[model samples]
Target: MARITHGIACSHIPVLGYAFDHGKEGEAYFKPAFDGFGWTRQFMAEEKPDVVILVYNDHASAFDMKIIPTFAIGCGELYGPADEGFGPRPVPPVEGHADLAWHIAQSLILDEFDMTIINEMEVDHGLTVPLSMMYGHVDKWPTKVIPLAVNVVTYPPPSGNRCWALGEAIARAVESFPEDLKVQVWGTGGMSHQLQGPRAGLINKEWDNRFLDRLVGDTQELRHIPHIEYLRETGSEGIEMVMWLIMRGALGKSTKALHRHYHVPVSNTALGHMVLEPVDGTVPPSPTLEGNSAAAQARIA
Candidate 1:
């Protein structure tokens, strides 16, 4: 069976790149993030995963308020950067893993996930930001990517539980593929920092620290919390912390943490990264439990 070589999670703030380009904040913070994921770049060089399931939210670029699908899978041959008021990035168009993507889409729909399959769509900073951070300029992205863009903009987006379920669906999709190749799944955005309205720049050091601590060992607890609560406590836009659910869902409950890092002051965001690989061949505990409190059942369901 082809295994997930490694999993990574981070925020895709396009402005972070603009800052690095314009020399607003010193390079001290961003540099380490790129270097620490050096293994990712190297893994791409060696393992050259045939597919990278990228989970990111679109920034009103490709799919505006017009029609926001809770989960949209891109099967396009190429994807360009969105203008998004900042103008498109000067980077080569992203290549897609059509074969693997189609498999996931079909499987997800059969599983009743109601995903939107896109063929000719442009990805915004929501994706390009993390891509740039993880992999610098190269003649071409080493591996093909299966873009899964979730709608975090519109009202009543998918619940944190739903996103977590999608991660499980993703694992199943990869496992079902008949190909012999390595695969990687990435969930981008949120450690904790709110940007939007006058409440922008709201950073809760205490909440952020607690969230990180639980993220590694007690993610099940974090999933039980409601989205609105995250907003009230963390901030409105900070609810994107729900995005982290996708990452937690990908790892086995008994997995070991390889590395972790946290830093604030990325413009107005808390930059965070964590890498989790399978441990001693132990399978992750099932997210669902047979008998649990109504709340626990609700969180996993």
Candidate 2:
């Protein structure tokens, strides 16, 4: 039967797409952040998931200040990339998994989560940047995607606990599907960075690293982190990290970090990525950052 096989979490910086489109991925300015994705791409190629349930927030491109859905799922034949000023990034449109998407939507609503069902919505960089980072510049994404857009952009977004519970409901929904499909849930956005105010260029590496540690193992404490703490310690936008909890919750009862990378100052943002597989052992080891302090080493091989 269809089942959640793994979880992937990463920051989705719009500049990553710009660098990729301009062939600046290898340039000195962006190489450190881009290099961190190499192991992820290789890992995805080896154990390519049939579908990816992408959890990300929508930028102004899809929904403006007028209205925002706390949880929205895209159930369309295809989801084209949004045109964020410089035209849509040159990546292939995201093909949707309708059957699974519908099933998930039905399951979530019945489970008491008010999920907005969307038939038409162009995904912004929040969705595309992570795909580009993990898959590289592919003509077409290798797997089908089910977009789960959480409303972290607007004030009073879903709580960390709520997102986590939604993910558990999703796990149940996926398990009920009869098709023998391999699935992966990806939580995109945020390590730690504030885009405005006096702390515009903030990058709390220590707090971000601590977050990565809690994310992989100490989920009980991690999921309980208040929004105010994310704002106070990480940054205003750091609240986006709540989306990762949904991905973590969907990963069954427990998990271990198989591969992880953490880098800083990627366009003034901390870029973090991790691959979590369900683990039967005790809580996974604290992310033993290797190599240098600026770059956390990846161990997928």
Candidate 3:
């Protein structure tokens, strides 16, 4: 059966993609920012995962106000790079693991977490920027990807605790799969920044680092944080941190924090990255309970 052995979290700022595409790696302004991902790239090379379950929010490219699913899973054979106004960043299309994706979709639904299944979709920077951050300029991504798009852009998005429980459902799904494969779940976005309104160009390094500390040292307490706290403390878009909880919950209850990188003023956002290898003997959720059940919540709590 497939097992999720590792978990990764990073901020997927569009400017990072721009930097990689424009060859700004060695430039004085961008060197420090780009250097933050050096260790992640080396780690990816040595780990060589077979599939990546990328959890990201679609930034008005794939889903607009017309319709948005609270949670969408891509189960297609391949996903092309979205043209986010500058012609798709000149990168190879993201390959998909349809068989595993379908299995996960079915499992999530059966676990009572509603999911919209997409046979075809184009991935925007929210999904690809993280890939570039870790893989650099490659002909194709190193491994297959299963895109999990959460509706953070839409108002009344899923709560932090709910996203965490959904992660447990995902773990149960991956564990039931018959294939012997290495899988990693990556949660992308937010370390505090507000893009518009009176609070534009915001970067709260103190809050960002505190959040990271709790995420690495005390994740159980971290999951209890509410959306209003993210909005008020981290800024309007800081709510993106909720998605990181999903990646955390997937790692069961314990982890070894391998690396942490934090930088500031990368465009309008603060960049954050961390890696986790699930500790052995961490308990997963009970398969008998519904994904959103109170008992399931306690497992994550």
Candidate 4:
């Protein structure tokens, strides 16, 4: 059966992509940020997962005001780069795992998590930047991807616990698949920094590090943090950190940190990255899809 081998969480600021695309890695301002992913590249090379479940938010690129899905999964054959105002980044098109994506969508719905299923959509920097950060300048992404877009742009995005629970559901779906595949789920965005308003440039290193600590072992406590606290303390944009919970939730209860890197001033955001693997070397038991759906139906009655 297919299984999620590990989880990854990182910041997906566009400036980091610009730096790598424009050959600014050697520059003083961006070197530290570039250096942060060195270990991740090495980790990917070693683990070599067959597919990646990329979790990120669309920045008004794919879904405009017309429609906003709190949770969307890509079930297309291919996805192209979106031109987010500036031109589209010069990156190869992303290949999607349509079969796995379809299975996940069906399973998640049966698990009582309604999700928007898309067969077509252009991906913005929020998705591509994280790929670039991990794989570097590849002609094509090294592995197939299942894009999971969370609605962080919309006010009152899914709560921390909701995202966490969704991750657990995804883990169950992945394990139930019959294919012999190795998969990794990634959550990208936020390390504290505000990109708008009078307090446009806010970076709280102490808060960011403490959050990382909680992610490693204290997620039970971290999952309870409210959205207002993240917004008020980390900045409006910093609320993006909630998306990280999805990746954390999918990894099961016990995880061993393989590698972690944190750096500041990557444009206006703090960059954080970490690799985590299940310590027990086995998938955890998750709520059965049929059971969950039945429970949901029972609640309505």
**RMSD per prediction, one decimal?**
5.7, 9.8, 3.9, 3.3
Q: What tens-digit string does per-residue lDDT give for candidate 3 at 118-215?
A: 99889999999999999999998999999999998867989998898888888988887889999999999998999999999888899899878876
- lDDT of candidate 1? 0.71
Candidate with better TM-score, 2 vs 4? 4
Reference-based TM-score of each model:
0.85, 0.91, 0.94, 0.94
> Residues 219-260, candidate 2, lDDT per residue (tens digit)?
567777888999998888999999999998788667889888
**Ranked candidates (lDDT, high to low):** 3, 4, 2, 1
Candidate 2 pairs with clashing backbones: none
Provide the clashing-pair count of each candidate structure. Answer: 1, 0, 0, 0
**Clashing pairs for predicted structure model 4, backbone only:** none
Can you write out model 4's per-residue Cα lDDT over 130-228, one digit (the tens) per residue? Answer: 899889999989999999999988786999988988888888788778899999999999989898899899999999999888777634677799998
Q: Which candidate gets the maximum lDDT versus the true structure?
A: 3
Between 3 and 4, whose lDDT is larger?
3
Per residue, candidate 1 scores C-alpha lDDT tens digits across 190-236 of 76667778788887778877776766653467667787777877777
Residue clash pairs of candidate 3: none
What overall lDDT goes with each candidate model?
A: 0.71, 0.85, 0.87, 0.86
Query: What is candidate 4's TM-score against the reference?
Result: 0.94
Identify the superior model by lDDT, candidate 1 or candidate 2: 2
